[model samples]
Target: MAAVRKSTNWFAIGVTAAVLVVVLIVAGVVWFANSQATSPGTLPESSAVNTETGAIAVGSGDKTVDTYIDFMCPVCNQFEQAYGPTLDQLVASDEITLNIHPISILDRASQGTEYSTRSASAAYCVAVDDAANVPAFVKALYAQQPSENTAGLDDATLASVAASVGASDAATSCISDGTYTRFVTAMTQNTPVQPGSGGIATPTIAVNGTVLSNQTDLTGDPQKDIVDRLNG
Candidate 1:
């Protein structure tokens, strides 16, 4: 009887161990699934007419011009102030498709406010809420860009800027709530591996999928240079 009891006890112990292992495995799978479900996928209500690869795009021309910029970069601000009008004109005339990629390379420069991310996320909000006004909203944001090391614009200021560009209350709410912050974070992380755009820096310009290495003169007329490049 003692021998039989010992054998039965061993079997019970083995069964209990097996059940515990299965429970652990099931718990791990559930946690992984939940994490994946919470991860950000793509921008909400993204439209191809004004967005591609997480960029705010305008125009439907044959030639493509991709502009990567960080709002906190002074040099990027200069580039925008110099070439913004020209780019807008080209897009308006359908001479070239203009795709503006708002990235968050300078998040650290905002003194812990993560201004670059906030601004980029706000831009995404504008894109989702008011796609047609994206260009205007971008120009306005650059116009009021704060210097690095500052706290950057607060949420109210950002919302006001959006309102100035005819963005509705929905856009303001979206910006305030940071609805697309996770999406912006994901886009920034994937910038290097972006299809047809490998390892880019701020103010990076690409014409027809060809990235430019040399900096074009900010003072010189970019219209002619852009036209030549497109024609070339």
Candidate 2:
């Protein structure tokens, strides 16, 4: 009888423990869901303002286009991957002047690490120090945005990436020092972005500060918008 009672007690204890665990797990899920909805702490998108240095020129054909992009954004990466080569061609041909602005509005984490923003800041620093190869540096970073929480980018990686794009140490150091924080900040907070005509998500291409592809003004493929203006 004693042994049987002991076994029964053990079973009851195990059941109680399991119930408590299930309760805790359910509560945790609720809390995490709430947190995710609130602020998952992702960095905000980059801003699209440039009252200071002015917007980038469109392809060299007397047309100027300003493009606002966030470094941490997957779509932004897709844009770079897809349209970067085409834009490079246009830039090489002097068909358009390009102003690429880094907007920072999507980098936040529970650990207070503004991942995307930091990368952007680094890239901005690169640009501030060396105005010529900003595009190349941006291409490099976007090309290798590691999965979140794996490992953050360090200065050495940035330097190597910069060097790969022909940026010298002096220029790379500027990226490390983050000298363009204010410039990048303004691009996010105070910068006034011209709306693309259609409401398509960003990686927006604007010609001479006018957004021709926003939902409102989308006449056609953004490239066509500028091409028409260029041909005219």
Candidate 3:
């Protein structure tokens, strides 16, 4: 009985060791893949654009507010509808600097269209060409937000959207050529993981550099919550 028990213990130890090794190998591969991801070269330059963080800056004020949004995220559209006016008012009053980070993590949901990346890249194109019109372009994109798992608006329609917002001249070519797709990917990868969350999520809001919780902090009333956060 003692001999059998000793053999069983050794077998269990060996199996556990093998599992640990496999887990370590998987972790290492994931880390390596992330490390080797594509790099964004020559960031878009504009007075209203943050070249370092890939955020489109709106309004210059004492306080800073950041929003990391995925174009294909429906919740982001809801966020925009709810808080867009409030943010605009704050910007107009010069109370807070709004940093809009256009990111793309839902490209897979776009049915091979890569709409998330394309739209984000188009926004960057607008930032490079007509910085002042970027906000309008964003609003337009959200207004025409496509359903998930559907092929999102095509390149021509994206350019048309830019034109509708008076960003046609250079933006059209930029969108058509997908000038900042890689940059969008890098920005998406760099999106800050919200507090209490393990991964990046759309419509991540940060006030004065503190990420807010959408479930607890933003559940009751987002507009009021954002204003209170800014004021507080």
The C-alpha RMSD of each candidate to the native structure, in angstroms, is 4.3, 12.9, 8.8
lDDT of 3 at 199: 79
lDDT of 2 by residue, 47-149 (tens): 3224454243333456665667766667678667666776777778887778876766655521345655566666655554455667778878887876544
Clashes of 1: 0
Worst 10 residues of 1 by lDDT: 189-198
For model 2, the superposed segments whose C-alpha errors exceed 4 Å read 1-60, 109-111, 147-152, 190-201, 213-226, 229-232
Local distance difference test, per candidate?
0.78, 0.61, 0.88
Q: Which candidate leads the pack in TM-score?
A: 3
lDDT at position 111, candidate 2: 33
State, as a TM-score between 0 and 1, how close model 3 is to the true structure.
0.82
TM-scores, all candidates, are 0.80, 0.62, 0.82
Over the stretch 51-166, how does candidate 1's per-residue lDDT look in tens digits? Answer: 23666777888888888778888878887877778888888899888987778888898989989988888888787877788888888988898999999999999999989998
Residue 138's C-alpha lDDT in candidate 3? 91
Ranking by lDDT: 3, 1, 2
Return the top candidate by lDDT. 3
Candidate 3 stretches with Cα past 4 Å from truth are 1-37, 220-223
Q: lDDT, candidate 2, residue 12?
A: 83
